[model samples]
Target: MKITFPHMGNAHIAIKALLAGLKLEVIPPPPITKRTMELGIKHSPEFACLPLKISVGSFIEALEQGADTVLMAGGWGPCRFGYYAQVERDILKDLGYSFRMVVLEAPDFKLSELLNQIKDLSQKVTTLEAVQATRFAWFKLNAVDRLEFCLAKMLPRVINKEEVLAIYRQALQEIDQVTTRPQVNQVTNKSTAEMEQLQQHDQPLLRLGLVGEIYTILEPACNYDIAEQLGRMNVEVYRSVYISDWVNDHLLGGLVKPSNRREILTSSRPYLNYFVGGHGRETVGNAVKLARQHYDGIIQIGPLTCMPEIVAQSVLGEVGEKEGIPVMTMYFDEHAGATGIQTRLEAFVDMLQRRKKSNQVWEQGEQLNAHVPGC
Candidate 1:
């Protein structure tokens, strides 16, 4: 059977590896572009979120490339992501496309059920083969995330950003092609070393924490490469989510690795005490975490009309005021323009820098006052 899945950042690389290991033909959708966005917007309901529209467009592209089956991740939450598969299936069927849809729900502490879903996907594959494939794919997932972390660190520091980007791209390509742990490690180590060696500016860097929907945070196209843009402006960007972390927490039941969900939940207290679905709680929690860490500012990004993020955004003002951290929220749709995003980002960064300078001046004044003799 041939399989295809929606493109979400670097997720397709690990997924392709997994399906290929199971001896299934994989048809990866073309990289997302303006045409893809247009296709999705044309077909999807106007009220649907950006992820839904983009994913629908991805499926249409894949189906046209001879993919007979589509694989989609499922969840159980107030987030509309749980309903995406059914909605897309109906949309595709209306478009007169013939294909099967497989929705693999998050394990939700049910490993056996998740295994059964895998078994259904590859009936002929033995238990041993399935285990091996999953292991290797997991390695690839971690490798990609680690390399990306390295890229994020180097982008703002390096004297030549493009060179670092080139190294990062080559590393991703290598990781995508390798099928073994050692090979993945070799690429990651080599690329990381290369980035580490690049000369960096001596200027102090402002750091920003990025929090919001997983798709908007991870998919550079959707967010217009916000992290990289900030880096180019001499600001460091740290994200609150990673695909590897999500997979471990949801798909593998945290057997391979544990996410910081416990800590995030604890930090989210007072500001947001309960899960509002998607990454809402995580957003508020991570923002609080970053504030405690002394990050210069926080940016919350998500698709337009996203309920969970909207809920999170509502609470962020209080978070910013209480924590003494400036926060900005940017919502995206097919109509989102790069110029507007860049303009707002520049303004936010400028405000943060000015605030930091003012705080420093006030602290210096307090120190001088403490040294003065009272009359």
Candidate 2:
């Protein structure tokens, strides 16, 4: 079967590696762009979340390019994501696209069932081959995450941003060209070293934490590349979630759950004690954690009308007031503009810098007063 899947950040890279290794013909949808957003907006319900629309648009494009089968990750939560696959299937059918849809549910809940699904997808490959392919894909997934984490750390400090970005783009291309885990490791290591060599200031201009729905945070196009924009403004950005961490927690049941996740849930308890939907709990929790860590500001981005983030946004005002950190929430749809996002970011960064300077001055004055003799 000629299969395709939606794009989420660098997920398609690992997915393509896995499916191709299984000896399946893979048809990757084109990179997300305005055209993809337009297609999704035209076909999706006005109130549907942005991710659903973008994914539907991706499938339509893939089908037109001869992909007959689609593989989608299923969910089980209060989040609308749980209903996406079936809804998209119906929508595609109505649009007269002929394709088969395979929805892979949470592997942590039913490991054997998830294995059977993988087995079905890899009918042509032996068990050993499938295992090797899966391992390679997992390696690529972690490697990409590490590379991205490095970028986030280095972006705000680099002397010439374009130099770092060029190397990053090259590293991605090199990783995509390799077929083995060792090659992936070599490329990632080389990229990391190259980034380390870029001239950078001893300290970042500012530090910000990004908390939001997974798709919007990971998909640069969906958020108008907010992280990069912040980086250009010399703000070091830390994301609350990563695809590898999500896979480890939700799919692999790896030995150690991410500490940040546990901390986030705990910190969010005062405001939101239960799962509202989406990443709302995580959003609230991460904001609390970042505030305690003394991050200058926090930004939450999500699709417009997303229930979970909406819930998180409501609680964030109180969190910001209690924690004494600035929090900004941004919602995106097909209509979001980069210029507007940049302007908002610029204003927010200015406010943060002034606040940081004032705090530094106040601390200095307190220290001086403590050392002075009584008069």
Task: Output the number of the lDDT-best candidate.
Answer: 1
Best by TM-score: 1
Q: Against the unseen true structure, what C-alpha lDDT does each candidate score?
A: 0.91, 0.88
| Error in Å for residue 81 of model 1 | 0.7
Colliding pairs, model 2: none
Across 81-161, the per-residue lDDT of candidate 2 in tens digits comes to 989999999999999988899987766665555566776886798877877787788888888998899999888989899
lDDT of 1 at 103: 91
Which portions of model 2 miss their true places by more than 4 Å?
Answer: 108-110, 202-204, 253-260
